[model samples]
Target: MNLTLRARRIAAIVLLGVAVTVTLLGVLLMIAAGTEDAAIEGHTGRADADVVSVTAGRTLVRFHTPDGGEHLPSVGVLYPDQLEEGQVVRVEYDTRNPDLVRVAGRGATLTILPVVTTLLAVWAVVSALVWWLRKPGPLHLRKLRPRRIAV
Candidate 1:
């Protein structure tokens, strides 16, 4: 394919934008996890959380605090990789920011694998698209005339 200079430039800009966006998303996920860990470390609360649901990649829990008020985090539990529905698991949450919670002893390190895997997957797709877009087209039929028979 013969791309004009303008088209190539546009494609380059779009690819760069996508790469930056993906990187930013991954970084934000890590940063959010770290922030939550910091919050929990500063002021922690422990409780026995009831696993209300467990799906392919997420788990939801419900629990009561010391004041006997029921609470369920809107985003569900962090580091829920091994949790099962109906199981009781100990959790550590930020008492000051009660919404921030995670399975006991699990922290931001649990986020690394999923973020890295997502980055790798996104880059694989983007690289493939870039390669396909930038690759040279096949030679024209006119450029490949059959050879004449030798005398």
Candidate 2:
């Protein structure tokens, strides 16, 4: 079960790389959520968008702004819960940028649960890998018998 020093060092390096990658992904998710929050806060408007399709992960909606232009947010509808295809649901959008839209009463808060869960899962996997990489030596019992004297 013993691991060579070089193997341990390599494991440490790989662990560090994985930690950095996971951290970066979490930060990026938070930043995107914050940006959407800011956009909503800066200028907000409401419209009943036509739901073109709905799925557990995302929803597609088509809505018209007061400026007389139809737009669909490139990222699809935000916080599109309990929605169905062909249903009309009110949404809050960044009037300055109509393409940024979220279902009414939904905001960046929804992003927290998924991101935290993902981080926890990643850490659990990395921790297991680290434990396996730094293996310990097998147990052995010492002899208890006394030695005989030489003639």
Candidate 3:
């Protein structure tokens, strides 16, 4: 095999492995995003929910949004260690649905994980194809001519 082909094969394998790892992480993050979405969609009667439980700065409670759905949400205000339980804090929820809620804002952060994983997956597939299609070395050998005798 040509040195180039060999090196490329190794690289392709590494990229494929990285792609799989990234895909797994993406799956986990996607799940987290869905869970967060669900949490905020629960309360519908009021503008915001009251903090029901607080150990420190963090609180757990059900929030009321414009949509009129309900959910039990656990959120950290300043931090779980700093805020008191039952402290009322303004939280954002889904506009279309009321039950979904969050302590801070929408869980848009989780979207990046899947996007990066998808990019890695595409890169891995392309690299594997390139490595597979590569043709190394010459197809045939050239013949050498005979040398003339010296005087």
**Cα lDDT computed for each candidate against the true fold:** 0.85, 0.83, 0.58
Model 3: per-residue Cα lDDT over 1-151, one tens digit each: 7777787677777767776776777777777776655655543223555777766444676664444456674443222333456676666765654444555544546476657768776777866665564545443345688888999
lDDT of candidate 2 at residue 104, scale 0 to 100: 88
In model 2, residue pairs whose N, Cα or C atoms come closer than 3 Å (at least 3 residues apart or on different chains), thus clashing, are: none
In model 2, the number of clashes is: 0
Better of 2 and 3 by lDDT: 2
Model 3's lDDT to the true fold? 0.58
Candidate 2, residues 1-151, lDDT tens digits: the string is 2357677769877996997798789979988988997898789999989999877667899999887899887679888878899999999999988888999888887888888888888888888777766665332345688889999
lDDT of 1 at 84: 82
Higher-ranked by lDDT: 1 or 2: 1
Instruction: Pick the TM-score winner.
Output: 2
Per-residue lDDT of model 1, residues 1-151, tens digit only? 3346457657866986898899899999999999989999999999999999988756889988898878888789988977888999999998987778899999999899989998888888878777665644432124667899999
Off by over 4 Å in 1: 1-5, 56-58, 138-151
Model 1 vs. true fold: TM? 0.77
